[model samples]
Target: MNDAPLLEVRHLTRHFDDVAAVEDVSFQIKPGEIWGFIGPNGAGKTTTMRICATLDLPTKGDVLVNGISVLANPDNARGKIGFMPDALGTYADTTIEEYLDFFARACGLRGDMLAKRIQSVAEFTELGHLMGRMMDSLSKGMSQRLCLAKTLLHDPQLLILDEPASGLDPRARVDFRELIRALANQGKAVLISSHILSELSETCDGVIVIEKGRLVREGKVESLASNVSKNELLNLRCLAKTSDVEIALAEHPGVLKVRESEGSFVIEFDGDEKDIADLLKTLVNKNLSPVEFHWHRIDLEELFLSFTEGTLS
Candidate 1:
């Protein structure tokens, strides 16, 4: 991956009248990295993204796409970005194919070029069969797929998606995640915002979190979890007696504390994955039979609650 970011938001601050909708937010998206932008309803996620897309101006700072300032050269920057809003923005009487073709034309494609882009995005989004279908008739999941197809029509390097998986079913959300993964693997920089943290945790390489209008946290999911967590726990279930298990774990340097819970030993571990693995190895070396041993890491949902106060901006 390139050391330089394909999309960079530098000290961005946006004001609606006297109220700061987004305040001094900064982050960078390297090529091929899929990042999640998260916060409460009034946390200024949309405000920040709109400025990044060049649809809104910041009161202070700026957004850069491929090193072009979004504030100074919005048209040039826009060509390098694909921005998808929370709403589908479907037309009243447009078919899926019609919408794509129209946008392709607007993007300066003519004849074969227009036809090819329309076909390519449609196929990638799995909207080929539904090309003739009306946009208004799509399900929430299908509408999001169509919106994604539209966004990809320009083959932009950076993607800004807001709440794309909001109302999707389990299967649709999974499909959406796979699509995002595919995009990132193909070297697109993606910045997505959503309230569904579990899914975000599964899909994103890392996340940038904000509270109200200011940045609160930013990093990989596991890294952020470590920062917010007091300590990590290892849940070990054994066929052996709890006393035997505790005795076996006592010799390991990584085991901080061990308490019996039901049929398992909830061990407070003071190390990383390698240390955890070594602990398990040591227990087996002590001739203690083990059935289950795994770390209980903090997930994104818990991390989000820990990071932000659910207040509107």
Candidate 2:
């Protein structure tokens, strides 16, 4: 197995005349990892993915797939990457199997090898039953699956999927998530974009958030949530009224603010685990018995909101 990163983007920037679609973005995806590419409308996610797929040129910077630069060797880069655009166009007259077969042939697969690859992807994507279905007659979810199967026909190491689950139903989304996980387990690197932050939080190993074409943040989901610079929010349910507990917490240097909730107090603390322990000790020392203490970790949605001001291109 290759130890190098499956995909690497360094200072990627794309300009359309006077408009900058993407600017100075950089990130990497390792083998067996699924990275979520997230941003609002017109945030340059598509442009970046296009450049990574070798379908578009970058005004500045470069993309490397398996250590091969896309700008320098686009054909080689394309050979290593399979790109599925957000809006997949299908041949209205062709069947699902025929569509995949066309792409397989285009990718230079033939004979038993081509048939084997098609059947393998069809089975993996659960599209075997839909093989004879017309592309125009398939549901959106099934169409998406067919597109994915086509992308996988080439057996690329890195898969770049743009808004893959955009129109999927609940069950379809669940199945798609499982498929992505299975791909990662098979040592394929997946870079996917989606507007569904909650689902991304559950499915992605990490995420790269960009806004106005600039990279805002990139890290593992849990790491990014925990590393947010903002004060940590904690909830405390005390055996007694939170009056004394509030006062005690307010006096502690680690506690920034304490607000009363229905039956507990919400504390904004500026400290780490040791500081939290010290604060709890101080509360207990003040004769305040906390029946429940829970630290609220910042979720991906909150972190995204904190970075981007809900701005769209």
Candidate 3:
């Protein structure tokens, strides 16, 4: 993978009149990587994206695409990036082919070259079959696919997608994930903002979380997960009665709580990993015969809760 970022946001800030919509946000996205941009409602994700896309200018900061300043050269920036807004308007009378052709021409493509580009994008998005279908009659999934196809018409190096999978069903969501992976495989840098944490965790290489117009965290998902506090987590299954494990752990010095299920025991400790390890070793020495013992890795939901100050829902 390329080490240099294809896109960079440096202390980007945007204000509307007297209100700040984005504040000192910064992140970088390298080629062939999918970066997830997530935040609570009204967290300024769209505002920041708009600035990066050159649709709006930042009040205090700047954006760079392929090492060129977007503020200095917006037309050049537009050529290198594609911005897919959350809500797109579809022309009811236009067919899919016509719609893509129109956008291609608007982007300054023409003649045989424009037709070829349109056809290629349609085939790539699996919309070749739907080329003759009316844009207004397509399903949500089909429409989203068409929108993505349109975005690819110019073969932009960086794609900024705002909730591209918003109204998709489970199957459609999975297909969209596959499409993102395909784009990254083709060396395109993608910045996607979505509320689907699990889906984003599964597909994106890194995540940037924003809150109230400021950046909160930006890193690989695994690294961000590792930063979360994982205190009081225990996973233990016993060879003996589960009650035995629960009781033993509950009576331990640093143990805060012990819960027993059908065949397992969860012991919440009030100490560090070293303490937990010592406790486990003590249990083994005492012959309580625990079958499973491991620290519980926090899931994406828990990580999100721990990191964000506001509600993500």
Candidate 1 lDDT over 74-137, as tens digits, reads 9999999999999977499999989998888888889888899999999999999999998889
| Candidate 3, pairs of clashing residues | none
lDDT by residue (124-232, candidate 3, tens digit) is 8899888899888999999899889988999999999999999999999999999989999999999999866776888899999888888888899888765654456
1 or 3, which is superior by lDDT? 1
Q: How well does candidate 2 score on lDDT at residue 89?
A: 89
Error of 3 at 24 (Å): 0.4
lDDT of each: 0.87, 0.88, 0.85
Task: Give candidate 3's TM-score.
Answer: 0.84
- Candidate achieving higher TM-score, 1 or 3: 3
Consecutive 10-residue window with the lowest summed lDDT within model 1: 304-313
Question: Candidate 1: misplaced stretches above 4 Å?
Answer: 234-294, 309-313
TM-score of each: 0.81, 0.84, 0.84
Task: For candidate 2, give the lDDT of residue 26.
Answer: 92
The local lDDT score (0 to 100) that residue 69 gets in candidate 2 is 98
Candidate 2, which segments miss by more than 4 Å at Cα?
A: 236-254, 257-266, 271-293, 309-313
**Model 2 agreement with the true structure over 11-97: per-residue lDDT tens digits:** 999999998999999999999999999898999999999999988999999999999999999988888899999987858789988
Model 2 C-alpha lDDT versus the unseen true structure: 0.88
Residue pairs with backbone overlap in model 1: none
